[model samples]
Target: MLADPMVLILMYFVLPVWLIAGFADWLCHRATHIESTTGAKESLIHLLMFVEVGIPLLAAMFLEVNALVIAVMIVAFFVHEATAMWDVRYATTARTVGPIEQHIHSFLEMIPLMGLVSVVSLHWGQFLALFGTGTERARFDLAWKQEQLPVTYVAIVMLVIALFELLPYVEEFFRGLRANAGRLVPAKARRREAGDTAIR
Candidate 1:
């Protein structure tokens, strides 16, 4: 198990911890946005990123764990979170949306997706054991044991990017049909969003 250092770091150090940071951040990020439905509240997603960011790295450092493992997770989680924030910034409104509009509202919909992704990974212990951490190094040699399970991979992959990528394509396709599911934004709302609508 403690054979290849890279696998060791990946399986134990980075994979699990990164999951923690990214998933937790994702959840908190979604909750904030869903609760308010306006303003930069959703932008606070980065805050969750920070909390779990250093935890794995720091723990790895003190416990003689793998720094490389920590580094990889930090990077992956950051990319995922950063893109999400931009998606939210681009979509800043709380218009009433039907199923189609709701689908097109990528950032808003991610709230629940994020919750599922982040919350599902709260089982840190299982992640560690699966990575091969029970004997010696508890968190520095795990290598995506989950990947071995194709079905699990499917679920994991879907949970990760389903909302961001898949949902958009579906929405756009249906949108072209003027399906009864979507909405043409009111001219006034569009104007307001465009900074043309006058204030009361």
Candidate 2:
């Protein structure tokens, strides 16, 4: 329940940007899954991505903007945009990745980042403790530094790695990806031996 003009402005400001960014990510992700490596110019993915990255920074341009919120939003989009850029780079290389792999990768990256962003937004309620959302006083401040800073910083940094380093570190990830996959296969030889003994 937010009623103040500032909250209203932030809502108006954030919703449209979220819609645009989410749509862009959806389209780009779809293209990666369908075409997997060949849909660029025809795709509005890049245009949408730019909008996404720009929105939070745009919000920050005002002198009254909340640094903590703006920082979270900016870092969130930074991670997202960086991921998009890496996808483009990897597709250009056209190495071992395919549609399923591309699809799997994009979605996997998004899940946790979204959760961290959620925490940043929700904690606004906790710090204010006013049973509502949006007000002039809701502007992010250092009043709660002992509580907010470290958690937000760590979350932002983790998302940044996923976005920026994900592609370059593909080889390192693959070893884990394959290892987890192998764990799923079960010990086939043991099963086979059991079956043979039963047959006898």
lDDT of 1 by residue, 9-98 (tens): 544444444444444434432433332232232233433333333344334323322434443444545555575555444334442223
TM-score of each prediction: 0.28, 0.31
lDDT of all the models against the reference?
0.39, 0.41
lDDT of 2: 0.41
Task: Please give me the total number of clashing residue pairs in predicted model 1.
Answer: 7
Query: Model 2, range 34-129, lDDT digits (tens) per residue?
Result: 222223321233434444544543343232334455455646566765757654553443223346545544654453345335434644543343
Looking at model 2, report the run of 10 residues with the lowest lDDT sum: 191-200
Per-residue lDDT value at 36 in model 1: 28
